[model samples]
Target: MKVIHIAGWSGSGKTTFILKLCSHLVHRGRTATIKHIGSHYCALPLGKDTTLHFEAGADPAVGIDDEKTSAVFHGICLDDALNLLSDSGVRYAVLEGFKGMPFQKVHIGILDGPYLLKNPEVSEVLSVLDQFDDWYTPSGLMKELTDEYPGCHIFSWAGYVTDYQKTKDLCSRIEDEYGDDPLIAGIRARVHRWSDDGRYPVYLLMAMNNPFADAAIFFRAIQKIEVCTLS
Candidate 1:
């Protein structure tokens, strides 16, 4: 799914802009989900079963009714949430206030910074939707990998990255460090240069004989790569 991030200071009409954007998308028969990232704490329903379950150490406490479902999660990061939304098959994932996120941004006010658009109308955003970045889950990455490098057994992978150069350098390091090992086989990387804005999203995958133990090492190696992202 394409990712759109709306960023601005308080009172910049961000919520109104997002509302208009989502409404327009809905009218056009598009599916979208919005995530609001706020600094202040939002209180849950007092004495509710879900809240009680959450307080009692459930990472994500879910409640279901005839009309809808509610979930309260603890310590869930933005990427995790986005992954969840992407898995739900939304066409557009709009981020309300994550200014620091790496994706292309639509700023609501004129400010001293770089953004895709300055106080753009919903139509303007739609005109340049192809310039936005894409998000990927592990399954998505594996699908891409399988399509590109058939016959290579990629048991595990890490992805949804934006920095191609850094990831390439890290992959080279991983090759030098572990390529000769018999356990880790067919280490592969894909740098997707499809974004109209010149950003490269990358994916790295490998087949491991011992998935549980080797995946830990693979992720630790991935963490050493310093990432620089586009706004």
Candidate 2:
């Protein structure tokens, strides 16, 4: 997931630009989510059931209907929201305001600041999409941990398997080989999307011992997985 912040003075066409960019992304078969930060306080209707539920101590109040579902969560910071979007497989995350936050920016109007684009069209932004910062995800977090701990031996795999039965057999084989091994500290396998054909974006992370522990004690945990065939 990538993050882009659209910032400018009030009434500077930020909203219009976002709509156009999102439409283009949809046409290209990519997913995008937006977060709008406003300066004023926006309140819900006084007698609405959702508002009542919030007033009755529900931290997050949700209302469901046929067309859409509305949810309001209190006390969540900006980074937390972006992480949620990344975990849900959003390809792009756009921010209407929040110029102060440190991320790539697309300035508008006569704003005096650093930006990747200034009042440019959607295609221009798409051409330079790689300039934006990547949002947080479990895989990214594990990579960061590996960088921090040089002694850690990490084996990670992500792929699209078109055979459902073969995927199951592979997972069972891994667990049977490593489930009782004391040296292995963590094993994570998740299917991000599944269909009749099989699963796409399956992620597996297996680490030997706790990388955060003393390096000397975990030195023996780096032994090779002799029975491992997922390489």
Candidate 3:
């Protein structure tokens, strides 16, 4: 899953950027946009199986739209939505509101905290102030931390994370070390459309708290290599 996320304040143009990115990527070939409505509630149709099931107290009632063949899981993590998005053939995914996710945050500019994070699994993270530790599906931090993810989860955008010039410099390093078949090609970063104070939750709960504490002991086990390169 190539996940490219936009993080910033509400009025920072995140939404507009998402639209533009969609158009840009669509011109390129294939891509899909996914928006995160963190902590928001939607009342399922009264007669729908999903709604009925939830009312009947199913821990998480999952519903499927026969016409569109789309599945909806209630009370599931935002990551769970990723599972669905990946399977749907969305080659390039644009994450509109995953400020707390470890996917390289693509901001319009500064990650204004009000629109950046929420419910961080890692302490000390107050929106724009911290990077996501990627707890549930533990990302690179240290070996003990990697061991906890339990599955071989590939980086969402191991081939298209674009932004800083330093990032471009890193790509050159990867090419020199790995040869012509380097994964990244160009910078994929873009200025977003939402930049105001947050209208959505920035943080969400993940599994762990302090991956860094464990990171210190297993530094060699984790490699902070960029999985995705810009376009």
Candidate 4:
């Protein structure tokens, strides 16, 4: 998944820009968004069902309507939320107000001054939504990852499959190659079967830290297998 952050001072149009960007992405692909309500308390209605459920110790109170669905998760960390989005098969994730995160950012309005420009991670600065361009199409973003991270391998599958055995086979191959390395082995332990609707796609991304690991081998192994690519 491609993750990016949008940040700016209060009333600097962060929310508006995010809404527009999300609308654009939704028309062309799948997208997820996270808004950080930092340091402020979000109060629920005193007698609402969702609030009552939370008060009764329902950790994440979820409410679904015919038209929409919302979840209230108290005290959840950013990484955990990100993992949830990834597991749900989001292609793009745009975060609002996670400024210091290592993910690339788009600054919505002016920074304080030149001192703020010292940070090297800012990818774009926009004063208004009209300046937005399609520079980061899905294929373009995937290409950027491959260019920036040399050893990264991306495997994707779609369409009807008999079962989860195919994914397991690919994971087994990866484990066979790197299971001896303690760090890689630890990461391998976390790999498990992914089962979601075939209508929605799935992606597996492996970034090898071992300098000797050949990403080409992974490509070659799966070359004959039917797979999806960022288009």
Candidate 5:
């Protein structure tokens, strides 16, 4: 599990960068992402029964629908969010916000001031997410995915990222192992935290050079490799 925190001031394109990062990961056929809204203003209207239930003292009143998007009234906590993703079994959770909280982060400041002195705890500080996916690849995975899937995006992960250094360190090793493969285009880690009460939401994927593989085989390869973390 790797956790890469994407942080910056308002209007600094934090959310936009997150969206693009999600796309790049998905194209590589890796599943990695966990977003934090940092706000509880998005509440359901009280005109409905769900709202009434919430007003009546239910912490989280869920409403499942046929659209495949389940609505959880009130808001979502980090643990709940992680459990949801764990159940889905994604490769990683590219979480948004939760900044300056002891995680490997990418801090984007406008003026590019003296950030090194600040204990912001970011592994990579860049102007944009595009800059981070700066892996050298012969084939253009981004362009191909753009043409083939259009707006569809992919996310991937290797199990358990608790800090930026851990995730970034593993990525460096992954690059050393399969950096030559055309499919191994880019590497980004999302900082995340989950619980053990329910099943884990994500299933880690293996570091592979070949872009094509059956899911079972990929799962096996992922299981064989051990994840290394930096403090």
Candidate 6:
């Protein structure tokens, strides 16, 4: 999933921008959003069913209606929230707040000055509140991998391989051998060069229905592949 954070100081139009972006993405494809309620006390009513459940120490109290379901998770971190979104199969996630966490950022109204200016992941800066169209384009917002995987059908595996050559050889071998296998389907490999550590991060995402089974088969075939420490 592609995740980006919209960050700015209080009243800098962070929420507005996030709402607009979410609307745009939902119109095109599946999208999920997370709002970081930093330090502020939640305004859930004093005596509501969900609020009472929370007070009774039921973590992640949930309430469902005909049209929508709302969940309240106490003390849930950003990563945990992201994991939930991923499990729900959201294509994109827009995070509002959590300015300290290191993820891609979209800044509004320039509150952090030089800090945001130097951050490599700060993709765009919008000085004007109404300039949403200028900053956001649904087609260009995220990296396009369609040329590599045409249907946008992909399953990612981020793990360590021996080296670049070994990674290439394994990908080539997989394509030659299991590319036609019904479970294996079309195997396309993209070696992500950027890594926090020196270990090679090889992604073997493909077009397949049973991704887990196919991934197991693919990894078993490549003896040099190792599970990555980072997700």
Best by lDDT, which number?
1
Better of 2 and 5 by TM-score: 2
CA lDDT of each prediction against the hidden true structure = 0.70, 0.65, 0.43, 0.53, 0.46, 0.58
Q: How far is each candidate from the true structure, as Cα RMSD in Å?
A: 9.6, 14.6, 14.8, 14.6, 10.3, 8.7
Candidate 5 local lDDT, 63-88, one digit each (tens): 66677544454555565555455444
lDDT (tens digit, per residue) of candidate 3 on 96-150: 7767766655666456544333322212222232242221111222222224444
What TM-score goes with each of the models?
Answer: 0.61, 0.60, 0.42, 0.51, 0.43, 0.59
Query: Least accurate stretch of 10 residues (summed lDDT) in model 1?
Result: 222-231
- Pull out the clashing pairs in model 2: none
Model number with the top TM-score:
1
Model 2 lDDT-worst window of ten:
220-229
Per-residue alpha-carbon lDDT of candidate 1 for residues 137-187, written as tens digits (9 for 90 to 100): 555556544555565556654444566666656667766776677767656
Which model, 1 or 3, shows the larger TM-score?
Answer: 1
User: What's model 3's overall lDDT?
Assistant: 0.43
Model 4 TM-score (2 dp): 0.51
Q: For candidate 4, give the lDDT of residue 205.
A: 38
Question: How many pairs of residues collide in each model?
Answer: 0, 0, 28, 0, 35, 0
Q: What digit string (tens of lDDT, one per residue) describes model 2 on residues 1-231? A: 667788888899888889998887765534656555567676888999999998887878989999997877785587667756666656678888887876779998878778888999889998998898656466554554354445667666555655545555565555566656676655544443324354444455566655455343323222222122233
Q: Give the TM-score of candidate 6.
A: 0.59
Q: After aligning candidate 3 to the native by TM-score, how far in Å is the CA of 230 from where it should be?
A: 32
Better of 2 and 6 by lDDT: 2
Instruction: State which candidate, 2 or 3, has the greater lDDT.
Output: 2
Q: In model 4, which runs have C-alpha deviations exceeding 4 angstroms? A: 112-231
Candidate 3 regions off by >4 Å?
Answer: 53-67, 109-231
Clashing pairs in 4: none
Give the TM-score (vs. native) of candidate 2. 0.60
